[model samples]
Target: MALFATMSMTAGVSPATAGPEQWKIMPLGDSITHGDGSSTQSSYRADLWRILYPTHPGLDFVGSQQSGQLPDTDHEGHGGWMIDDLRAKTIGWIVAFQPRTILLHIGTNDMDRGPEPEQAPQRLGALLDDIEKAVPGTQVFVATLVPSKKAAVQERIDRFNAAVPGVVAGRAHVSLVRMDGLDPDLDLRDDLHPNDRGYGKMASLWGAALGG
Candidate 1:
């Protein structure tokens, strides 16, 4: 993986020299990031922006996501995507955008389509490697997969979350944001997606992780 020392920004500005008013944040992940089962601009991404921007006043949270898509910024996040698909499409966009920070919410797709539970760690590690290679010094915040009400899928999600910390352990720049108890009720409309209240909770969790 490639590594670059933190590049200096002008007066707290980012590499793109995006002004305080223009600072951009790219949300990269599966449907959760795409705000599945919700209207555009009403998803968690927007909620997170609203929660954080007031205090920061320099960041612009931009959505490069789509429903039922993978990692490609222009495409929608498909309901189920594996680690390979994530690495293949998302890495390129992260490199291109070079956002100050990346808010990631993946692995649900991996859990849904399984038989390769053991490979989750390796795949997640490679995805991290690709992110570090593409944009050295970028802060990669790995969010633990949210809980699903479905017994089988929820169990798989639990296992995936359990595996993530170890995969990212000892990496100075990577931090894990635990979402375990954010909503114990699993308040999702379906076993797969969250409702408005759930999205609010998710946004709050992200805000706390980001120091909002």
Candidate 2:
């Protein structure tokens, strides 16, 4: 599950098919994924929807709340949420949305302000485990955390990202999507979330990840 290996293998796995409810896709994570730092309060999920669904016209974003662009206002991103919190709720979410795909970009808030940042990856693994167990055929795109400028914070982020590949190892339909290279000082609206241009870059990165 190394990034290079995952990148190579992820290709040619065509996107999930649209069904009666469209191919439900859930963007799952914390405030950064929730678009907290953005002026419009819509994260990359909004931009990602704009870029992919317009041409594909097959997938539908789904979640418990709506907070993004029109026609794309669905995701499971909760501000200030932690990995353990997400793990606890993922099963119920899968039951509710029945998503074929999950775009996961979490761990930032945990790294920044966790009681134990070092344990974030293990928690992430558990979350993915829950998802795979609950939804056997679902695909998961696991993103490396975007950088935090502070050295101490960024170091933890790196460690969490390093452990991500192993977290997904031998797991069905789970792949790592690179995000650490998306620099936080430049891309972030403040200390955490992506700005408008950053969101666009994120959407483009997701496109590259999905080969869209």
Candidate number achieving the greatest TM-score relative to the actual structure? 2
Model 2 error, position 139 (Å): 0.5
lDDT of 1 by residue, 54-164 (tens): 887877554455432222223224446767777888766765666777777778877886668768878888888888887787787888887887788888888888988
lDDT of 2 by residue, 1-212 (tens): 57755765677332362243367789899887777777777888777877777566777888987786657788899989988988888899989899988899988889998988988888888888888888898899999888877789888988998898889888888998888777676787776677887888888888778767
RMSD of each: 7.1, 10.0
TM-score of 1: 0.79
Clashing residue pairs, backbone N/CA/C < 3 A, model 2? none
lDDT of each: 0.70, 0.82
Relative to the unseen true structure, what is the Cα RMSD of model 2?
10.0
Indicate the residue-level lDDT of 78 in model 1. 40
Clashes of 1: 9
